[model samples]
Target: MYECYLTFRSITPCQQAQRYLTGQSLRSQLLRTPKSIAFKGCGYSLKLNDTAIGLAAAKLRQANISYGSAYRIYSDGRVEELYL
Candidate 1:
């Protein structure tokens, strides 16, 4: 299973994005941004499958929801930005 982290500037947008994705039938969960990449003390993000990444990002973009960035998470705990 492929996983990716969708980061946001703040919690509200992060939550909004999560709800929005769910409405679009994409499975997502609110999660703390990995400590190594977190921007603030309580940074939050949306974790979703890679298969849904493109559509989720597109929906957020269409809704004008802002996101910080996206990262593909590896099983070994490594991460790399998803260049959308």
Candidate 2:
């Protein structure tokens, strides 16, 4: 399975983005942003399958919901930043 993490500046937009993605038929999980890449301080993140990454990001943009950054979680436990 592939996983992606999308960080948000705050909890509000993070929750909004998760709800928006759910409405669009993409499944996501709300979780605390990884400490290593948390925005400014600690924050929230939407964890979803890699297959939904592009669509999720696009939909979030279309809905005007802002997010900070994205990262891909490797099976081997490495986390790399994503440009989406």
Considering every candidate listed, which one attains the maximal TM-score?
Answer: 2
lDDT of each: 0.83, 0.86
How do the residues 1-84 of candidate 1 rate in per-residue lDDT, one tens digit apiece? 346888987889999898888888988989888875675566888888788887899889999988888888777777788877
Worst 10 residues of 1 by lDDT: 34-43
- Candidate 1: regions farther than 4 A off: 39-41
Candidate 2, superposed: residue stretches over 4 Å from native: 75-77
RMSDs, each prediction? 1.7, 1.7
TM-scores of the models, in the order given: 0.86, 0.87
Candidate 1 TM-score over all chains jointly: 0.86
lDDT of 2 by residue, 1-84 (tens): 446999998889999999989999999999988776774897899988888887899899999988888898776777789887
Give the local distance difference test score of model 1: 0.83
Enumerate clash totals for all models, in the order shown.
0, 0
* Candidate 1 lDDT for residue 55: 84
